[model samples]
Target: MNEGLKVFLAVADERSFTRAASKLHMTQPAVSQHIRSLELDLGAHLIERNNRMIRLTRAGEIVDRHARQIVQTEEQMRRLVHDLASTIFGALHIGASYSIGEYILPVMLADFSKKHPGVDPHIEIGNTHSIASMVASRTLDVGLVEGSYSPNEVETEVLGADELILVARNGHPLVRDSFVTIAEAEKECWIVREEGSGTREFSDRFLEDHHISPERTMTFSSTQAIKEAVRSGLGISVLSALTLQMELELGVLQQIRLEGLPITRQLFIVTQPSAFQPKVVSAFSDFAKEHFSDLTQTRTPVHRTSIDET
Candidate 1:
């Protein structure tokens, strides 16, 4: 019945069933049937027809004013529904690489939750590569990672910068010289994150660029495990400065300043294109970016070399 009203309104506006049919993508007979149904429901003759032209009867003129209002109401209702879905409340599934998830996101999420208590945020931690794949598949609504993402498949914005540096157990021989040369650093054994991790990606690029290869490499699936292994004197590892804040303060692990060190990489916020983005995702993403912008301005810079060196 409502569809019949809409068709009749179209027909009335167009002043021809054939034109209305063309506009509505329906056959002329279908348009006439809709008008007939509308007329039967109203118990009035809405249109008077000649051989090739039609005019609205008095009843239709009355109905036409009301029909326009009804159509406008429907449009407003649709917009309200869309607005509620986008901004009000829903579960937000977020994916992040281990470095960002463990070291960066907890505080951000806590702050966000305080402001939007109705929104439930659940996080999945993985390597950057895996997290990017999840975003592409629509499994994760948003992603924060420290590695590169394909601009073609996923939309990315720079979140911030993460500074990478080398770490070893306190009092390791490498730190005695204040700075180790690339060739000298390569001779040491290394404990590192797995191949797909963002840290590993940076480390691999850094190594290849400088032509440094460790004598042996031990892989760990997690940042915590790598930190522990490095603390126990298994070997030195390259890690985000953000992750080593507590350890550096506690003196459990010491940074080994390498010549030309502190590789800075851009952290990224990733999502599907705007067409695919949900309301909650856009809200949170904007909130986070604004919050981090203020934070970056006020926050003291992390020393590129050892804390004591600064």
Candidate 2:
């Protein structure tokens, strides 16, 4: 009944059979069959269906709670079995913010895979906020983010500090003097990362601190897109120094020093606090925490996590 429980949970959570089927990649009829089969096995109606609406019965509510726990427990059992046999095994789902996911994670993931070949990593890259949300919802086993997250919902540990840089195309007038005044910086067109981006958060803070408001602004969801826009002389942007290494080395883009600029952001590893932390997840988190400094090529102390603690 593993599939049945999963189907029920999806239906109950989505409150729409069509949406749940699309989410699970199953047919609408198949989803209905699973629910019907579940009700028959339990001898009770699980949900009340009216037209396009669905609501769980009292029995369904209890099953929903227990089913979630059962699914989590079953995954823990599988991972534990694999760990006892091979020390580590199974897929590890990891979420990361754009900068770390693109320029940082591949390096660490490569090394982690070399040492633990049995673990397959599935990575989803997004902004810091979204990544943290997924970790809290248990969709992602672990997350590497550059922004702040809720302390009450998820456990976090500082992985490292990422340096933010102000970048413009080479020969831009703003950097002619090797430094930009607040007034000069405010006059130029600014390109920023999309809403909810950690890089954008720092950029916004910088503008607020300097009291510099731009006359024009452009927003892009992708870091690379923003970089390209900056390169083509669309507008200057604030981005992670790690993402600018190649362009800086190539003389295509230059880092500009605004007075009291160059903000630093803390990188964090976020995980859901739970009683049972699979060996695979713990091992990967430990590995990433210890090796995060390599991303910045700095020697510094690392913090530890207590996610597995009861």
What overall lDDT goes with each candidate model? 0.82, 0.85
- lDDT agreement of model 1 with the native: 0.82
Worst 10 residues of 2 by lDDT: 301-310
Across 64-168, the per-residue lDDT of candidate 2 in tens digits comes to 989988886677688977777658888788999998898889989999999999887889999999999988988788999888888899999998887777889
Q: Model 2, which residues run further than 4 Å from truth?
A: 4-69, 81-86, 298-310
Q: lDDT, candidate 1, residue 62?
A: 90
Candidate 1 weakest lDDT stretch, 10 residues: 72-81
Per-residue lDDT for 160 in model 2? 85
List, residue by residue over 35-132, the lDDT tens digit for candidate 1: 88888988999998898788899999998888866864564354345667655466677999998788778998998898877677879999999999
RMSD of candidate 1 to true structure, Å: 16.4
What's the TM-score of each model vs. the native?
0.69, 0.77
Task: Let me know the TM-score candidate 1 reaches against the reference structure.
Answer: 0.69
Return model 2's CA RMSD, one decimal: 7.9
